[model samples]
Target: MIERRLFEFHFANGDKNGVYHAVYAYRNPDGGFGHGMEPDTASPESQPLFSIMALETLDEVGYLTKEIILNDFMPYFQSVTTEKGGIPWMFRPKSDYPCEGHFKTVKEWAALSTTAPLLGILEKYEIDIPWMKKAEQFVWSEFERIKDKHVFCYLCVPRWLTFLKYTKNQDKAEETINNLKKWILVDGIVCKDKADEGWGLYGKPHSLNYATSPESILHSLFNKETITSDLKELVNKQKDDGRWDTWYGISEGTKLEWAGIQTLWALKVLNNYGEIEK
Candidate 1:
């Protein structure tokens, strides 16, 4: 059960029809139980950012069984779909071109969504396994092209583990485990400050544009997992107040929603280490 304070945005104004008079765009059309706030740009919900962030939350807080979905999330993606069904970027759709998300094919699309992660952590949650062979084949093949980018972050772990788990590819799993360290900002994550004036595959971080890139994302990625003393140092920095400002600025505006999102994201890493959940 979620605290009412955190959940009222969806239930507070809901009608007898089960629809909330308020609009949470990422929500199912009926305005049923879901994880995001209103999706109207004028409101705090402009970015469909919460869609994945929410899935990540549900991923952590043991709520995905009830929240998260393709139907509910697809409208946002549908706005961007180019063909029968394809998601270029998980956030920006094909229509937002130049501003569109990357990964041109449907296989690429699944990599961007929780589809990969959910499947990876499935057995951990006691979920089913179907068509795993095809799923594993697709993700590993695609990672070779985008491993340097955040796109890789979404699927690398899952794909690597998939090969190890289903295909019994120990050699490949070892390779993935080796590279997993590099993916972590072990130090920090780097993102450009603003949207580029011209088009590119993805966007960059805002604050650290001038000083020189530091390790924010990787550091954050490993923040909850103390496999190394460096990660323990970073996670320990969480304020007594129970928050860590992705302060280096990789997630500036996102700080507003960072508390819940990062808290849960951090927990995932920690859980990976067999540490007890806080």
Candidate 2:
């Protein structure tokens, strides 16, 4: 679809300005992203996870400027961060912003889902804020506490892996990798529905449930052969409208945002594998 073309153009032309603007359009005044960049959290208020998405999107397009990080982004994140140095997944919503599901502001806790990548992002820029140092300690402590792979928090594995990989924390990295291998490789990705998961709206967590092939980020942990079937399934599951679908329980607007992100991720994997021409 048009989003695919935009994604293709993003990588092919080496122009990130358009992509940056598209993503930036969702940025809240607080310097964090909102207005449904994450789709699941439609709250216009600054949410930590959506902020991570914003930074990652900027990083992906090479538009992660110091201005964005130092002046605009960090302040907002810093303000919302808890005393323990961990960021809650979401915060209180703006009066006009409608939130649902996991998007609502509840008990705030530093989540691996948010902190790991936020740490990685900070490290990438060499921006050593106080929270960064504290976050490292918190992450390692969390790692020590988590003795096994958590299925409900399965969506967060890659981000934690990325954090470990970036920090070169071999011990935690190996443990996480092994845990993921046991869960996904040995046990298998679990979802509510097994029969019709290929359509994109299935509740079951397949290899492609969150993004592209599992091997995209976890290549060191898994070979192409292991996830090749799922990768191929991604290509086969493309809807006639040119967008790959996702689960339908979320608001349609949120679903569309996720579809855009997931579709771009899928294209990236296919392009990397030479399955699709650039």
TM-scores for every candidate against the unseen true structure? 0.43, 0.81
Candidate 1 segments whose C-alpha is farther than 4 A from its true place: 1-26, 30-115, 122-133, 147-171, 181-242, 247-254, 263-278
**What is the clash tally of candidate 2?**
1
Please provide, for model 2 over 1-278, each residue's C-alpha lDDT reduced to its tens digit, 9 standing for 90 to 100.
32443575656674667777777788877788777665555556667877887777778767786667888778877887776677777665655566664545466777666787878777777677676888888787776676454543545766776686677567767776576666555443544233575333433555554334434555544455545766677688788998876675367776777778667766776776667864
State how far residue 15 of model 2 sits from its true place (Å).
Answer: 1.5
Pick by lDDT: which candidate is best?
Answer: 2
Write model 1 residue lDDT over 96-207, tens digit each, in one string: 2222112123233444233344335444444443434454455566556656555233323333343344434558755755565555343344332223321111133212
Each model's lDDT comes to 0.37, 0.66
Candidate 2: Cα lDDT at 20 = 73
**Which candidate gets the maximum TM-score versus the true structure?**
2
Q: What is candidate 2's TM-score against the reference?
A: 0.81
